[model samples]
Target: MHRVLLWIKQDLRLDDHPALQAALDADRLLPVYVFDPELLQPGPLGCRRLGVHRARLLLESLAALDGELRQRGSALLVLQGSAERLIPSLAERLDMDEVLTLDEVAPEERAQLDAVRQRLGDIRLLLAPGNFLLRDDELPCPVDQLPTAFGPFRQLVEQRLPVFQPRPAPARLPALPDNAGAYFASLPSLSQLGLGEPLSVANSAFPFSGGEPAAQARLRDYLWLSQGVRQHQQTRNGMIGSEYSSKLSPWLASGCLSPRRVLAELRRHEAQYGRNDSTQALWQELLWRDFFRWTLLRHGGALFRAGGLKATARAPRQLDRRFQRWCQGRTGVPLVDANMRELAITGFMSNRGRQVVASYLVGELQQDWRHGAAWFEEHLLDYDPASNWGNWAYLAGIASDPRQRRLFNVLRQARQYDPDAAYVSLWLPELHGVPQHLRHTPFLLPHLQLDALGYPRLESIPENWRPYLPSAA
Candidate 1:
């Protein structure tokens, strides 16, 4: 009888899980998740790979996954310590004939796979498709041959869109191996993981819980019940509410929901509602996600380096007080601070707000882009290394079409996106007393008046911001 160990990495759910499907033929199966200490330890960039918010979500997800498996006569085996050490040892102790897992895209994750494989010895280490919309063979061109710019890449991929058919979850997973009861350990709490419980932010745009069930509910609500996707193009930039965007990213990043499943549902929605600009916009976002995944595959470790894909490129590497202020949302720029505070408090930010804050960090604060990226890795509920790092590199002008440096005029963007400064006031109550017209440009107020609000003062204002500042200020 064949014994198989299904290694569950970020791909948490069994629905449409390629690796789980591949392991079904085994007479005995065990699904295991190893919580690596490296994720909680600070990296070279001075930030832990996992933070309190994502950690809470991750624990909830693991519990939900366990419950699902239990219904199918199986249970998730939760372990701790180094994956390279634990996975191999578990396989041997269980006498697993082979170990199967989904493929990974990021350099660090790929390195982990290599380490685990080296330790597996004679046992086979099988890899299935990763959490992406397109399979390697289904891409328009080879990873190396794909366009460096998103525009050209999107164009090429759109030429022949593949029909996505996501598989359903197995009704009954194979029974667990004998003597495996000890391995189905209990999940840890946030405090036990050396992190405090994150406060519940009432104004958080992403108020949803973690797990496959929540992910599926979100997908259904977005595409069917509420049909909010119909206006995604118009409201996606809004920072206040959940209806603005699909909000499917956290689930996607954690593999609680399959990308192919999302695409298939999107196609069904489009077919029922008749394709519109909103649907097209969401489709483009998926394409961008895939583009970043493919980019990471092509570039490997370079995406996380100081210079990114451009070896000769000059990029900031300084960690100054300004970077700290930016992270704390005390930069005295209303829009930037509001967005940053929202992220710090809620562990989520609007898509539009991310661009604004990232540009400010790289262009205005002039801090190391990796520091900002690392901070996001710690905070964002939807942190995907490929999209997160790839985007930071793009904004820093060192990856994905180096010619584009996304520098935003903070004052201008504030007026355009948060004209009433509601988003600003929501996160930065200090600015609530400031007049709506002068809210975004509080720095223009006299030092005495500004000090009264307890808001930090901008050390310097860009010349370009003069045009966007209100005349009354």
Candidate 2:
């Protein structure tokens, strides 16, 4: 009987998984997931790059996957090592004929795949596309010819082409080889992996469990029961709660849920509940997600660079003391500080919070944009390298847009999104007494009044609050 190995990375779900299906097509399959030590090491953010919450969620998800596989007379082999070393060694030991995996587009990820390919020279490496809606080569424009703006790109794709429907889940998986479980130890715990305890559910916006089933249920509830999807466009900028957005990014990033699954379910919801402008707006956001994935695939390492693929000049900035304050959420900017503190405590932040804090870091403090991006990489449960880097580049005016340095007006933003100061109050109790209009500008309050109000008093504004001024690092 032919032996095939299914290497699980980000694509963890059993439903609509092309790699898993391909492995089952063989006579006997060995399913494996390697916890790479490299990834667990501290990134530039000085934190365990994958925080405790996500690590715990991954363990739970893998356990669920293992349980499901066992019921089918198969098992998920959990290993901890560099995949480049583990996969080839396991293939040789098991005498597997081929390896099946989902395609990866990120430069670092592609390098890992290439290393595996080189090591397992004779073993067939079947790469099934799971990460993107459109294949890299299938775009209407050449990689170089793709539009720099999102509007034109979306318009072109929506009008000229159709997004492929997601594949159905395979009816059943093939049984594993008799000795598949012998090669690995038990899955590691959060503490074992050097990560802290799982986050307290009471404090988290994304309190739901991880796994395909949980993800699907959340989607259903959000779209149908809660009807949050109906007002997604309007309320998505919410700061204090979970209902503001779909909260699917964590699942999507972890591969517990597929984007296509979300799209299909969204279509079902629209059909049953009746379509509206809100649903279309939600759809637009999903398309944005797809666009970023496509951008990384086409641009390669340039997405990670300072100037991006187009090679624009980046504004030079110094990492100053104010940058440290921003990082620690002590900037005395209530809205910015609250958002940063929230992110520090919980691994998630609202889209509005993300933009505000990012802008404050790059624009207000004049810190290096990359530093903020790296911190988000470590802290965000939903951190996808492509989206995180792509967004930072955009905010820093280093990528895509000709209007570089897109900084938000903090006061204006506060009045518009958090007009009642409810979100600010939740995270910054000191700011609870601040009026709705002044909550975003606590520094503007007189020292005696600010002290009476219990808000931290800023000594003075940084000398470099000018628009488009490059921060000194």
List TM-score per model, in order.
Answer: 0.97, 0.91
Per-residue lDDT of candidate 1, residues 1-473 (tens digit): 89999999899898999999999899999999999867899998899899888888899899999999999999999998999999999999989999999999999899999999999999999999999888889888778899989999988888988998888999998999998987665798888888989998889999999999999999999999999999998999899988899999999999999989988999999988889999999999988898899989999888898775673157666788999999999998989899988888888999999999988887777788989999999999999999999888888874223465447888888889988988898998988888888888899899999999999999888999988988765
lDDT of 2 by residue, 141-194 (tens): 776688877899888777765544676656567877776666756788777777
Model 2, runs deviating above 4 Å: 44-47, 201-203, 308-312, 398-405, 432-438, 445-456, 459-473
Clashing pairs in 2: 317-471, 317-473, 318-471, 318-472, 318-473, 319-472, 319-473, 397-405
Candidate 1 total steric clashes:
0
Q: Name the best candidate (by TM-score).
A: 1
